[model samples]
Target: MTTLNLPVVVSARTKWIQLFLGLVCMASISSPQYVWTLLTRPLAEKMGVGLAELQVTFSLLIILQTFFSPFQGKLIDRFGPRRLIAIGTLLSGLSWVLASQVTNLTGLYLAYGCLGGLGTGIVYVGVVGLMVRWFPQQRGLAAGAVAAGYGMGAILTTFPVANSLAAYGLEHTLWLFGAIFSLVGLLASQGLKAPLDEVTEPASRFVAQSSRQYRSGEMLRQPLFWLMFAMMAMMSTSGLMVTSQMAIFARDFGIADVVVFGMAALPLALTLDRFTNGLTRPLFGFISDRYGREKTMFIAFALEGCAMTLWLMSRDNAVLFVLLSGVVFFGWGEIFSLFPSTLTDTFGSRHATANYGWLYMSQGIGSILGGPLAALMYQYTGGWHLVFGCAIALDFITAGLALWVLQPWRRRFMQQQA
Candidate 1:
């Protein structure tokens, strides 16, 4: 394989540099999905669509980012990181540039939805896959660090994007930022290469627990993969629902414009949520590294479920709502780190990218249900209570599955393979 022939740079410091490069690449692509909420209202008005209809663009972006990830992952494995990620960076930037000129729904969907989705998917899966191989001793933390980039990268740009949209025309803002995203992302991607074997072969739970390397086909055949898929899909549904719908819900609840500490409540909540979301990945991933994956997952998932319930109860209180949203994200965002690390632990790292690609499809399934479907639920039910209730239910159910079912099943599956 390419990994074997790649020059084995034995220095541990170089691998950390690779991890940072991957982080930057991930950050470059994150705004497409993470900041989509900011564009929803203006885009809806400009395109003459309802909130639900406008959300379809968000759904498509996620669907393409996740659904096509397996192929993108496999390609990264074949072609190496630098080439593929550079292409993804350029495509992501171009998507926004193309989006700047669009006057209709079809054009918006094509540029922002299809192109943006594919581009971000490529960078996301590719960088994540690279991290797993590069830091074999700390797979969970490595994954979490890069995933944190995606979760929090928008923090630097959220206010800027919001301000630019208001101050300049949306088209001008999109074009200017798109150019920067493309240039910066491509430059970061150039620093990425497959890790040498010396860097990738450190002893870890991922290597310790797995009985054998499983190919993508074999991984698909295992019942364990499907169970993880279901759990991930459920988790993704709850998190994505909150992520895509939060701005709308805040507005509807009449707290979006309410200010605390001289800042609008909704944006402040979003900023806090981004912080918690980024923090949780490495926090919980480090916990899982020491305490076992299932235990950490159980705790975090239950926290999200309870946090959602509290958020709904305090809906009218802007301060509580803002605080609780951060709590909810703190509980939810770690799945990006946890699930991928868990999957590699079970299946081994030879096909890590491809295996994760299949697992990532659950996120796409979730984006469909969580983004547009959740919005539709609000439209039909005349309130967000029902939507929040459904998400809470899924959260608890998945938490139960993670603790009671996944732990035992994976243990047995690995034993049998051994």
Candidate 2:
């Protein structure tokens, strides 16, 4: 009997596959979180809904994460990241076209919230999990590289998106975005595939306990689980705060152009952060593997929290001077890989995919909370000062929490930790 093969190759060409995966994640994240404001007003005006009501479209997409992410994780594990990514990219295109055809909030929710949201979740899990496996020793750098691609998507597409808005109008612009997203994403997502070794039989409470398999659920019972989770979430929340409000905050702080703020923030932040954050992943992961996950996490988190607090307090002036992002980019760049490194170190190698899935979820959670929280403060209190103050407070509290939990978690998981 003859059997068909996948025609896949592992070569120099395969690097593009990883690059595509990064872009797919970039485009997926950019649409729902970063670019919403650009679309929100026009869509609201077109649909005759209030801004907040239109904003519900954003809320629903995020809210759906609770439902979609797990299933996406399942699909990613089953079919490999490449197939799911292609399908998701196509679906995302269709969602845009459907959204452009809609005239009401319900339609918007159905297209953007239901379809596009889930598609993104699927593509994200498979691509990201694949990236980790591809660069096993370089997880943090890999994570940052992929994440920075995501960060740059909005900027890369900004021109086409704007040009479409001018030429096509609101409804047609959605259609244009849909088509463009699919093409670019499809091109980028080309090389995404899970390693053959990733398949596993479902098991409980067993930690995969080694690099051979990493199970986050099993790790949850370990003390290091909560510590790393909290550490990542805290640092993520601060970055999301910066992500969520930098443009508006820049304008409020006397910058003439909010657009410039939007354009500059991600590149500047990601440029430095991705390198440091990525390099830290393996370094810290190796450290935790040798010493302990908890100690490394405690140190990493402490430095991150301190940097975040100091940056936040200095933000008004530096940010007011348009140098605030530089300050933030410096302090806030270390957490991405360290967070996962901590998790992988504590849980052992078996659970990297599952645990990292959970780790990635923190950014999603932070994205949801950070954006509106900053906006709400501005709405209620009438200033960006409160937003800055609140961010500072959160970072300080996060530092204390990191210091308190990590050492103890380390002590308990000392032997099994990476």
Candidate 3:
């Protein structure tokens, strides 16, 4: 039997260029999510709100970014990545710009939370979708690379933004960086275009992928898809807790302001977390490509559980706190790579963008659980220990699900498809 394939209309080099452009677009919009912690304190003070209340802004950002991604992904699939991503970057930047001028909490929510969420959501889903299509055989690595852009993109701004927040104040910093983010992302997105055709490669000897394409609605109905969604939601909660609450917990641990290796512990840890977080995506993705998605997920998720346990234990030590923060993120950030790749492998690429969008909404569910709800839990409990403990439990549980449940289920699913 012969396989019917879409003709390869673009050169191999063209896809690489497309990947690079997607990465750049991703990087340009990274600051909103990754650098959000740095703005939390100032924003809280400015709006005269409590930590739990201010965290609603973060929740809104994540909720809109993820909850609405299905629509955004569909738009990208219909209109192409270039225009939508360009608009998204501009909206993302404009969120900060408008946020800087706002005087009330509601305005902040609308500007920074809603607009920013919608914008970043578009670019994120669009880029990941584009990368998976462009590099079907190498989906894990490609998705990881662009996801790394989102995770690590703030590395370039973490220190600079910190210094700016200190030197120029929140208004000027937000305005300047907002403009920069918009211009850079817009320029980068101009070069992005989805692959017009598929180029099939020899099937991997290790990993099994679906030969038939499933549309978004059909994929959504599968028990296997819901299982992946539940798994992703747990992982997202574990990771987003660290991401959104690290600063608060660091301060509570009495290490936020402590100097560790010359820099403040909080910023230092944040910077290192960015690096490890960004590094883990492509690293684990590369491994997943050769080994298997569930195996890589198990290893990485277990590592995160161990790292979080260590991090909680070392909370009192500034040096260890800074170091272990990176380890914690290293374990958590690979979800972006593994989930989308696995989704595409199971569902096929015809509707990969929209299908992944449905899966990505799990992150929104996670953001709610991990962001404001975790903060509320901390408020109710009077400490972060309970919050951290719950997150640790989730990490191990999801890891177990991946290895024990998902692996076998996916194997059988692919077999039935065959």
Candidate 4:
């Protein structure tokens, strides 16, 4: 098979620079999904929609972002990151800009849900695939760092966005930030490209167990891939349920306006959650690098499960709520890093982007089950306990799967492939 070799030299320094560029691009596009919670109440009020109705936008964003990734991944492989990401950056920013002017649910859905989802999907899948190839020896770390940009990027904007929504109104804040994100993301995209063919060598810790490069179709035939997909869907559902609905629940619980460390608890929790979420990717990725991916998954996934339970038990205590929310994110955000790195390790980097795209679609399934469905559950139940209960159950199941099912299954599959 002939690899498409990069024309220019990519030194270690250059690779790091490429990763940084991807990081910045990912960070710039993060708020549309991550900060959706902050915008939920405002958008609902403005459009005269219910919480479950406003959440459709959130679900659409994840659905488009994850479901279309295989096509986006193929585009990245064909056209390269620079051009594709540029288009994505433009669309992402444009989504918010159009959203700022929307007067109804349909307009908001088109702007934030469809366009924003497509754009972020391109940037996300492209950057992750790029990282796996770029840092063959440190795939986990590379994936984690870029994923951290997405996971934690909202930290830089949370307070400012909350303040802007208060002082400048949602429309002005959306327009201003949208313009800035578009500019920054485009600039960052210019620095991205596929790694040199030579750098695509496999360097996973369990290198002796590696299989031949699998195309997207070949990958889909593997039972292991489906297992991972199921596990991803479960974890994604649990995490996204909290992520998309945190602010609403906090408000309903009467803790949203409570002061925590001189800032409103909701934004404060969000800021802290972003930090821990970002921190966990690299930290757990590094751990997975040495200790193994499934082990790390079991630990972190279980941590989230426990954190969610504790957070609910202590819902009335504002301070505990804020702290535990951070823990929950810390445990959950590593999924972005772990899943891609593991998929690339199992299937090989030849089709890393496209292969992971299929696995990533699990998030779309998860968004439906977790985002809108969870919201709907709350609407009917008139309480969040059912939603939290479902998430908690899935978390423990995924944690167990990571250890018992995923680990042994991967070992056996790779041994057979070898």
Q: Write the per-residue lDDT of candidate 2 for residues 2-115, one digit (tens) a residue.
A: 977643434545554665566555555455544555576578678886544565676566545434665676666766666777877777667788998988889999998778
Query: What are the root-mean-square deviations of the candidates from the true structure over C-alphas?
Result: 2.7, 6.4, 2.2, 2.7
Task: List candidate 4 stretches off by more than 4 Å.
Answer: 1-10, 200-202, 205-211
Q: TM per model?
A: 0.96, 0.74, 0.97, 0.96
Residue-by-residue lDDT tens digits, candidate 3, 188-228? 99988876655555555667878899999899889999999
The prediction achieving the highest TM-score against the true structure is 3
Q: lDDT per residue, candidate 4, 72-92, as tens digits?
A: 999899988899999998999
Model 3 compared with the native: what TM-score? 0.97
Q: For model 3, how many clashes?
A: 0
Evaluate residue 154 in candidate 2 and report its C-alpha lDDT on the 0 to 100 scale: 61
Q: Any runs in candidate 3 off by more than 4 Å, and if so which?
A: 1-6, 198-200
Summing lDDT over every window of 10 consecutive residues in candidate 4, give the lowest-scoring window.
Answer: 200-209
- For candidate 2, the lDDT comes to 0.58
Q: Which runs of model 2 end up more than 4 angstroms from their true locations?
A: 1-29, 48-51, 166-168, 198-216, 254-321, 329-336, 349-351, 400-404, 416-418
Q: Which portions of model 1 miss their true places by more than 4 Å?
A: 1-9, 197-200, 205-208
Give Cα distance to truth, residue 251, candidate 3, Å.
1.1
- Pairs in clash, predicted candidate 3: none
